[model samples]
Target: MTNSLKNLTSILLLLFLAPIVIATIQTPLVTQTQLPEEKKKEETPIVYAAQLESSPIATEITEPKKAFVYFTHYQEAYQPILAAKGEKVAVYHPESNITTFQEQINAQFAFHQVETEFLENYNKQEIKEYNTIRPFVLNALGHNKYDIILDIHRDSMKADVTTLKVGEESYAKFIFVIGGEHENYRWNEQLANNLSDQLNKLVPGISRGVLVKSGKGVDGVYNQDLAKNLLVVELGGVDNNEQEINRSIAILAKAISNMFFQPIAS
Candidate 1:
């Protein structure tokens, strides 16, 4: 070969070799920079919605049972019924007493009997707890072989509208708000209907109605399918006192207890 042709070939070889060395040297640095971007992704926030059976933990609890539970107090929707009728606003005050059942309701209401009992039994201690209700629910399921989870809460609305007379006694009306998307959705409705009917007879106007929320929302399902019987019941509004709420609790608890434990009609 001629000298000029050999030189041209050498130049071509150098050009190709230079890019490979440069890329090889830079590869480790490029990978190091990616770590921060990955860490940032880890910190990104996530929005939770229903029909979420994706997590590895989701498939662990699947069985049959009734769970009674309560949410940590998250709002001031119920303020009037907290303190005396004419007294100052202790609405946001710490709930020191009134555990198990509301005073009036405990005098009457009982929780539904179930294999999976979800009652926090905080007994009016505090409502705004964190991730406190369900861990116990899981444990209760373990202890008693329970399957469903029901967390109870009161509705928030104007007091004058909520307070009404039932026979000679005072009672607050309630609406059974059930999430519309759970597998047990229909059964939940049936439970609500049965309870509503029974309460209507036991304490009229205590049931506002059964509200089914089918749209996208957090409460449409309160982790009901740990078993198919899970449900959350919003008994009374905040304007109604624990005492007035108790009137409805009696029949409410009985309805729940009976449904959970009784034999299904054939």
Candidate 2:
């Protein structure tokens, strides 16, 4: 009887322990495997966010260069265009003058992402035009910083000296005049030389080279003392018509864009 009782108790204990072991194996312990994968998914977005923050496009922004265009001799006119309209004077016109070039210049500069401001209205009655325009230019400079300042003028010389012909197209030639009297004249000369080189590279012989004037009977300073980059550009002469002058303005705009605004390759 004692042996039978002991055997029965052992059988009952084995049957109870077997179901617990089976249940533990059948139900998977997924927490250990799934935790690492969840962490990896969470870290991926953080790494991608860091990469975007360090990108050059996100960090850097460059603004377009600004140029100021003015005319000391606003009435300077083209002879051919004047004659066509039956006007008497070849060099001067009250209404139709070099100031009209502001439209063309602004249009061309806009294409190259350059901002331009024109000081068109000034006292015309003053005999000393350069002196009259000086105050206005100084005031403009005081208010805003200009990268380039141009005093556009027309030469008294004829077409042969002021025109360039490339194939069938005629272009008005450019002459960069620097004042030799100023203390900072060399800096202005260097700027002129750089532009001359750039212009010639675009269209050979389009520039007549830089000319320095300083002695008596000339406005030696040409108001260039106000700013180092201020330059007097004699665009064409009395003989160059509207079409030629327009072509030259377009070329000049491109040269300015390339020299000052374009980025250099390493």
Candidate 3:
């Protein structure tokens, strides 16, 4: 048993065992490679394409919300004097006709069938002036949550100015009035602009455009502070008759329905 013979024997044994150790270490790597695709997918932290597509955060846009319509000035009727022929007589118009705009909106359209609630607190003497309608409006807002609140009114504009010809019949062109007094006035303006855009699409000249108002000579806020999408819509002029108003109402209902309930394509 010489020293060199002993050292050579030890080196050979070490080489033989090294291969075995390496093979043993490689066993787990082979097992992992041979694992099922499903099991591999489960163990991996990466999200799959299908899962990414179906995620709630990555979903499509939602449908528009329901709207509520009410008139603050319930007795604000169209003045008949403005409808008279000749040089468009601008006489002292003071007669308040009995027919209610609230009834007209409810009757002319199928709004009752849809997700629409109309506030009908009608009395000529009670909510007489524009200023007197705040409490009523505030009360309405307090009770219900609405995505849109339309303060429907007949404008003082002349018929010739407000009238718009759609197809065969004539429609009283409307204006979207957004109040600038609220903190979320931009949201209100955006909604008004969106509605105006939608209306103008159906009838080119139907919408007079969005009018943002604040300060003196106006109610300023117009109770628009209550909701983000509240709007004051002037339906037609003092001269526009019930027939014209009804036609405008029908068009409005169609436009609103499309804007809100219209489904997004999957």
Which candidate has the highest lDDT of all? 2
Ordered from best to worst lDDT, the candidate numbers read 2, 3, 1
Please write out the lDDT profile of model 2 over residues 1-266, one tens digit for every residue: 99999999999999999999998899976788799999898754211111111112121214677899988888889988888788885688887888877877877776655778987465665634777788989999999998899999999889889998876678899999998998999988999998897788777888999999999988888899999999999999988998888878877877888898767768
> How would you order the candidates by TM-score, starting with the best?
2, 3, 1
Regions of candidate 1 where Cα sits further than 4 Å from its true position: 1-69, 74-78, 85-91, 96-132, 146-149, 257-266
How far is 200's C-alpha from truth in model 1 (Å)? 1.2
Q: In candidate 3, which residue ranges exceed 4 Å CA deviation?
A: 1-66, 80-99, 108-113, 121-124, 129-131, 263-266
Clashes within 3 Å, all models in order: 27, 0, 0
Q: Per-residue CA lDDT of candidate 1, range 1-266, in tens?
A: 69999999999999999999999887855567788999999965332111111111112223334444545453433455444544455534444222335333322222233223335455434435434454655566666644334556656665666665644456666676676766777887776777676556555566677888867645556555455555556656666665566555555655555555568679
Which has the better TM-score: candidate 1, or candidate 3? 3
Clashing pairs for predicted structure model 2, backbone only = none
Model 3 misses residue 92 by how many Å? 10
lDDT of the candidates, in the order given: 0.54, 0.81, 0.66
**What TM-score fits each model?**
0.55, 0.74, 0.63
lDDT of 3 by residue, 1-266 (tens): 69999999999999999988998887745455556876877854321111111112222224434567876655456655345322234423224332344555544334323345676655536765556776777787888887667888777788789997544567778998887877888988998888787677666778899999989888778778877878989888877765666667766755675666667558
lDDT of 3 at 247: 66
Clashing pairs in 3: none
